[model samples]
Target: MIFTRFTLKWGKRHWALVTCLLLVCCLVMPQWASAHAYIVKASPGENEILVAAPERLTLEFNESLQTAFYDIKITGPDGNQADDGNVHVDADRPHILETGLQAGLGNGTYAVNWKAVSADGHPIQGAYVFHIGEPSGSPAGLSDLTSGSGSTGGPLKWIVSLTDWIQYLGLSVILGTLAFLLLRIAPTSMTREPMDVPGSYRLLWISYAAASFAALVSLPLNTLYESGVALNELSWRLIGSALKLTSFGQIWMLQILIVMLLAVTILSGYDRDRSIRARIWSSYGSLVLVLGWLFTHAMTGHPAAADQRALAIAMDFIHLIGAAFWIGALTAMAICLPPLADKLPSKVRGEVYWVAIRRFTAWGIGAVAALVATGIYSSLIILPAPVLTSLFTTAYGLVLIGKIVLLIVMLVFAWRHARLARAATGSRLSGSLKAELATGAVILALAAVLTHLSPGQPAAAGPYQETKTTDDGSAITLQVSPNVTGENQFEVDVKHADGSIVNDLEQITLSLTHLDMDMGIYEITIPKNDTGVYKAEDYISMPGRWNIKVHLLTKTLDALDAEFEIDTTKP
Candidate 1:
């Protein structure tokens, strides 16, 4: 008796704690975008060096690109006027942005800094470095390379993350709860005589309101991310820009409307005696509306701009609904099922719980099967065959692997509980289901991060810009462009105290190291350019701080060494 009472008390307290942890994990962890405003492809690609400078710059995004709200700045060997100072968008290809390069450019390292606006008003910005002729010690404007990550601050990111977490949570609740009603409850509900499930309705309302609130707040949060403006300082102009110009805004508005319709249909269905035929049609209408709402999500993600988009969008739609039914239903079980079993008349208690558990087990099985199938399809098209190896090699791929492992674990728990129910674990099944919910909670949290990460593919895509000086007052400010876990360009700018470029350095070499894992040193020569800079192209296969040792051979000093560190950001 003491153990039972203790277990019950702990369960009651810990349940809320667990739920809060789920949301906290979703918010605090490094956020991965859900492919809302993802890049489809770039002209030179990340860390790619061209033998000759391209005539112009072109960028293609997954969603419609808005130039009016964009800031495309390029600073290379010659300082900021590398481009013709105009970004052009073709009427035929609003999704593509292009700008002409300045005439008579020489061979040197060039860094492209761009901030493009998605139709949803979110600004997607990044910097890429390419070698033109030969390497200068460092490009003229190499110090000016802006990676765009700094453009949006921590406050904006956290606010955006919080709202996004709420959105995901809300989506799980709305879709999963409604699914439990239509699929698990409604058909059998006819036979159960419709007892007053006050807790169930209350749970439904909370989900509806949470989802509605998240969807509503999503607009302002989108504005905050795009404009780099604080939530309070977000003017009507910015909000209007996001809603009118971005794909996310348009889709979000439509969702609010559908959410209202969904609430009406669900709330009305509570009345069991009110014309069963009408109720069926209303449920069917609500289901159709829910599918429509899900399409908006499909349209706004990586699929919207990806190759074979129709296939990707269809797969993503099914994937989300399946996930909602599975995770969301688990949430409903955590919130509603225990109370439901209690409300059943004593004579029918055990039988009703058994019927519901069996029914939900089948539902869970279908949802899992759907998730697996769609997940495979998404991986294939998004990452492509050439980049498949990057999954195990890159940070993004490692995170994806972690998510897959957790999913497998969650699946095991689901399978175990189904067996326990079949063995008639009775009230013990309640404890078992709660355990399953905890595992599933983590799976949902990881899912939120997966979308933002590089698909580890064609669009496969970091931050390292620092300046260091030597003893003789000669500055060897070396900048490693695109400090991602893949390809990168290293440029070392050797200049005198008078600020004149040093083109006559006898020899220059570099060493890259990651001390933590004992990931040894990678050394290479950074030869001098016609323009007096030293540079070389190499791929770094990890995401962390890299210790750089720059060795310079000069007449005054036999061997002058300058050391500095560059921090690479994981994609």
Candidate 2:
């Protein structure tokens, strides 16, 4: 009600200004947007036959991407690199990426292998061919280079998810404990100090320590998450480069500052009655630290990609603060406040409980409103009208739905607790508060996964996906590309029965069958290849796993069929 009144008093002009700012962000904010990042257009173009080779290669995408991760390796007709300099993002345009080409070349064909990560934090990659004079053969190394690009799969995603949950959970405890001490216990205590409840200090310390530890572990974990690399074989070069060059690196470095400041703020105790100015100044300083933390968080997540740059960030900040206060305060109430209250005289219990309840409920109402509003706003940003159906259809949507369900359950408990707080002298939300915290953990985990999920927006390009090798020995390498439902490119690298490269083959045919549906056999033409490599392009109308049979024929050997499955997970 207070927030509502404030908004109304601020007038329609302020709201209009907010709208205009959002419009700017939506149209011009390069830092804050994309559902999925992909190459929108390329200089040479995909599978183009050009009379002359381009002097420079430029790639444009739908999203602003970190150039640190954008790698370009152009192999010419002679199986050698065609480019001279490192790829760089266009100074004026963040989405436009370019690399200068090495000249003096007689080209047959060239393959551009690219890998880039969106600012919103999705990996994308592709391999495309362009002919300078005439097509000779498929570029050999490229097939392997682009094989498993753009996939956010494997165990690392889950590990990243776990780390994210810890960070948020720990934040909740810090905010909740600190708020409770400063607001409720400290005001009325004999010392009129923030540490009236010694248990509150302990709670704050544990949460602070846990959060700091999570932050330390998460840097490497986040780097691994971004690179989609295995822990044992993580590229130190990649981590080092990211730390030095990327926004994520900048955010991590800032987190270090925030951690130090937060520790200092907590250590500098407050005696409000003795020195209100110092206490007020310290609170202001803490606010700045909190804002910095929120800003850094937004820089790495959806808010960076949101259309209205400032508005989106504001929403993210409010959402975080609200959730942290509500969840953390409840946790502190259940853990720290109750025992302290028990130690107090029975005469004072009623007054303390009622007053604390009044203050918290007011805070809770505001927090709940902010969470609900921002959650909806963010959802709309991620999933627009037509594709909004994906809110139920996609895995991302399903997880969001689950989060909403848990929130609704907590809201119901909250309504009951509010009534109990007003009516009872000895307030007890013990069971309900615990339930809320438990539900909140799951909510944060779901959120961690949700942020990583592709919103399946129209702007999003197909998932860059791959399939595991069917066999170990001299087996065919099958790449099912742009791993979303649509026209998919299937490239088969023919390896002999003896695990040797079969560059000379008489006949190679590729056939497909829908594994999930009753759709029968469908075969596509195998393009001309002097090499044993078989390339096929066809429309895969729907998503899901589909079985493909690659039939190989030779003059000396009998026919052979290699099996692999294509998983078109989502668009």
Candidate 3:
């Protein structure tokens, strides 16, 4: 009866303490619920590079962006179709959209044009120039790179890195502590060291309870963000559909694995030979954690095509594992330490926990090392600007820097606690250790906020321009030029014939409209410039989709209107 009452009283007090800690964790972390802007870098700075008729052209963004919104166009000096096929996203980096142009682009100015929407749902359009030193005899279709009118915007992408950070830190604290308790910390038993401590159940309950909550909440949040659905109405169907579309669906499988691991542990606790069963169950749990790494994060990372992909993957793996260890250990400490500290012999308790912590310290060191090295390498690949500038200017870079700083502080606190705990001075040392743990709590909160930042998209200037022109005859020609000073010239020539031209037509008046707007429409009087030819010439400012409406009115012909779409390139 006394033991039962003691357990109940202890549980009440400790649960209250942990509940407060959970609130503290939530309070310190800031939520980023909206989209962030990013700028992917361009070659030779937009319109500044001079290529010697290179075989290909490339454009890069600030973040590991998606290419669905990508658009590209290339036209020759004579306003003729020099592009062969439609533009396409690079198979290697979906974030990289590219297209091939016809060969033998003569030495005259050629336009290289492009437009795209960012992951944040913002539309970005621009143009650039690259000169082929001297025009070649290669046919236009040799490398068909053309643009058309019927283009739709890419699906909107959401930023989930902030939530990922929160998940990472929380998992670290919960898992790291469990591993320590199972593998290193011990309670005295009849013939062997007991992996289970008196209050360990409470610790596991709190850790797993919180973890389960995070998993559940993150699921809906992730779903809601991706589908643009309200959280309350996010149905299984929506989730299923989202999973089929995006890689995040794998989390559902991971959640199931965790549940299975939990079930095995619970079942083993009731077995006659609990010790053997417990070990088996714990090993299964560890396996689940490892698999969790594979199913969720490893699957969601940047395209694994770079030469340093292996290194980046390794770093991300270690970083995640280290996070799990840290957060897991903290959760264990919060749940177990307060209730059990007074029950065990001072010397024995100190030796056990200190040894466990010593083991953990090595793991922490490795995780930190991997996180730093691999993180830098990863940043170099994705973030806009040079490595140094990205670290400070970009949103992703700032968040990483914040995480690194907080981690350093946490390490310092750990070092101080290690020194104090190593002395084995009993209660006074425990007090200090608890204080250090408080700092760990703050560190976890910071990590949660860090997860929300989006990488890439650095601030940069746009070099895009647009122009419109209409022909008096039935045929309308629109020329798009990317005024890149140092690069090759690009031009787009559009032709429209609505059977509205007549031989006796003396004058042809044409008007231009760009995307239903006519603020700066340029007009062309046909048959005059061409000496009886019925086409007009005008310049398009940038590379992107355009709309042109031809107005046909001849001296003896009825008025006719026709609409057509054209994608111009930047030269």
TM-score of each: 0.66, 0.71, 0.52
lDDT of 2 by residue, 443-481 (tens): 877877776666652223354433333444456677767
Comparison by TM-score, 1 against 2, better one: 2
Clashes of 3: 59
- Sort by lDDT, best first: 2, 1, 3
User: TM-score of model 1 relative to the true fold?
Assistant: 0.66
Candidate 3: Cα lDDT at 373: 50
Which scores greater on lDDT, model 1 or model 2?
2
- The models' CA-based lDDT, in order, is 0.63, 0.66, 0.47
| Backbone collisions counted per model | 17, 8, 59
lDDT string for model 1 (29-142, tens) is 321222334445667554455688788888776557664457656677766578888786667988787788888778777777676755433455656566676665455544
Tell how far residue 76 is off in model 1, in angstroms. Answer: 9.0
Clashing pairs in 2: 22-308, 25-307, 26-307, 32-304, 32-305, 32-306, 33-305, 474-499
Preferred candidate (TM-score higher): 2 or 3: 2
Please list the residue runs of candidate 1 whose C-alpha ends up more than 4 Å from where it truly belongs after superposition: 1-68, 74-85, 99-112, 117-123, 127-141, 146-161, 184-198, 229-233, 271-276, 343-348, 384-388, 457-571
lDDT against true structure, model 3 = 0.47
**In angstroms, how far off is 203's CA in candidate 1?**
1.5
